[model samples]
Target: MLFRVITLFDEKKNKIPATIVHGATIEIIWTSIPALILLIVAIPSFALLYSMDEVIDPIITLKVIGSQWYWSYEYSDNLEFSDEPLIFDSYMVQEDDLAIGQFRLLEVDNRVVVPTNSHIRVLITASDVLHSWAIPSLGIKLDACPGRLNQTSMFIKREGVFYGQCSEICGVNHGFMPIVVEAVSLEDYLTWLKNKINFDFNI
Candidate 1:
């Protein structure tokens, strides 16, 4: 119907009739249809935003500090040894240090480990410059601004290694800083966490 109307208008010689030009039905259809479509789209869009911002009772909370060319992670929830939290710096593995079948510029010396099927809260901040802690597969992209803490939540549903990089351009070595998240089963994660807290193992 719309195509035929457009065809009829295109075939007209000159002086388009005011009845069709200023038709109330046409005006209402154009305005109301787009408004209705937008309303439909906005429903799910707002729902996603609210879901992303919703804070659940997380089992573990991880603090991420972004520096010029590296990322530091802290497991502060279950710190029992001392008042200080368990902290580690995750650096990009150099090309020469990479093992067989390892991805170049994607592997890190340490990976941020979290248990599958657990609600995890991540607090992100920058020590020096602005950076973005992003993971494409998990749909997380958070800004790391100096002196300010940004919070986000994640619930890992599967066990795998998800890779990401700094989305913000902080410095010349910004590309060198990559993010790696290793999601494992709850038992394996607890074992790894025990080793991390006890032996200071970089797992």
Candidate 2:
């Protein structure tokens, strides 16, 4: 447009095209395009947000707790032998102690386990400071605020390992906090639960 204007008005000093001060067509075009684009984009956004919020009668419920530099998880459903729920803490692996094929600063001593193709509920909270529980593959990035509880639901579609890290800058060692999720078949999950139950019982 600038080159065209320069070529057209090269010999004229004061000759200029009149500007469209008030064109209803231009106004409607400008207004309707973005609104139509926004309407198209919002359909999937609202669907995903509403789907994440829906609980859908989850088969398992997991409670997550965040501290200054570590993450704690609790299996809060379907335990009968013990009054307290199954709980454990996860910490990031040190560089020197990392095993072969294990990702440094991403591996943890414990991994949160769940079953594939099943609905799961996660309740998040912080014990001392603010933290965020984020898993990119699962589209989860909920805040773990102190004195308040936040909840979300997830459904693992396949059996695999997913990894994430603490996204909030709560303290100096915040980078050291990592999260790992192990998704397995339902039979394998029950076997793991049995083994875990026995181990916790023995402990």
Candidate 3:
């Protein structure tokens, strides 16, 4: 699509004769074309945003609290959850902890976990300075402003570990806070959750 647009402009520039057409026609032509293309993009984007609130079934709910240098995750509901509002602190992995295929300053000790294809809503806030929760693939990011709760809904379509980082500068360790999301199959997620609740393992 982008190549087509650029090629169209190049061809227009080459063929447009100064003696034949006025500049206003060129402006109108480009303007209308882009407007029509923009409409094509805007409709779907708006529809996706509007459909965020709609969910089939949510198996878990998590609350995230951003502090000076770390992130805390809590399981707020236990209908299909496994943990006592467990708080897991996510810290940036240091150079010593770096491994092959792991990101420098982008890997965290603990990652936020969710089930693939499950509707998950994240509740975000800050304990001190403001921060932001962002995950690109899942298309979620919101301000974790102090004293205010921000919400975002997500439905993971794939199973893998996706990473993000703190977008807001909070304190000295602001750059050290990294976000990781582990998406797994629903059965595996439920099994892990059950194990976590049974004190089988620290998930």
Candidate 4:
């Protein structure tokens, strides 16, 4: 229809018909087309927002604390740690300290461990400066502000090591602070939890 209208206009020396120029069709077309397009786009957008906000019965809850050039993780839902939670700090592996196949500035000494196919809630906060915990594959990017707690939900679909970084510029060493998430099987995660609990207990 548009092609035909353009062709007609070109053939008729840019002249428009009197009926079309004065018709209600142009007004209705302008309004209804945009409305229809918005309706088409809004459904999925609203669904994604609702999904992001919705928190299900999470099997585990992890608290992440952003510090100066490093990240700390605590497994708050682990009942084994009755008094102290299973907490550990993750530091960036320098280029000289990196092992074979390990990425420089991207690898960390410790990785955030979780089980696959489970609903996990992550609470984020900063100890000093502003930071952002983001993972591209998981589609999560949350701010870590001082004195304030932010939260997000994650459900790992598979088992792998996913890497991210402090997206917000907190300080000079912000580039060195990296985030790594290690998703394992349920049994492996339980074994890791037990080992970490024992290690913390011994300490």
Instruction: Please list all clashing residue pairs in model 2, or write none if there are none.
Output: none
Q: Residue 161 of candidate 2: its Cα lDDT?
A: 95
Worst 10 residues of 4 by lDDT: 14-23
**What are the lDDT figures for the candidates, one per model?**
0.91, 0.89, 0.81, 0.90
Which candidate, 1 or 4, would have the higher TM-score against the true structure?
A: 1
Ranking by lDDT: 1, 4, 2, 3
The candidate that achieves the highest TM-score relative to the unseen native structure: 1
The ten-residue window of minimal lDDT in model 1 covers 11-20
* lDDT for each residue of candidate 1 in 54-124, tens digit (9 for 90 to 100): 67899999999999899999998766544668899999999999999989999999999999999999999
TM-score, structure 1 vs. true: 0.75
What residue runs in model 4 are displaced by over 4 Å at the alpha carbon?
1-51, 199-203
Show where candidate 1 strays beyond 4 Å: 1-51, 199-203
TM-score of candidate 4 on Cα atoms, chains taken together: 0.74
* Candidate 2 TM-score versus the reference: 0.73
| Residue 202, candidate 4: alpha-carbon lDDT | 29
lDDT (10s digit) by residue, model 3, range 1-203: 99987876685586873464558888999999999999999999999987765554666678999998899998866643443566678888898979898999888878777899777878899999899988777677789998998877787889999988888878787788889999999778867666666755434
**Number of the top lDDT candidate:** 1
**Span of 10 residues, lowest total lDDT, candidate 2:** 194-203
Cα misplacement distance, residue 46 of candidate 4 (Å)? 6.7
Compared with the true structure, the alpha-carbon lDDT of candidate 4 equals 0.90
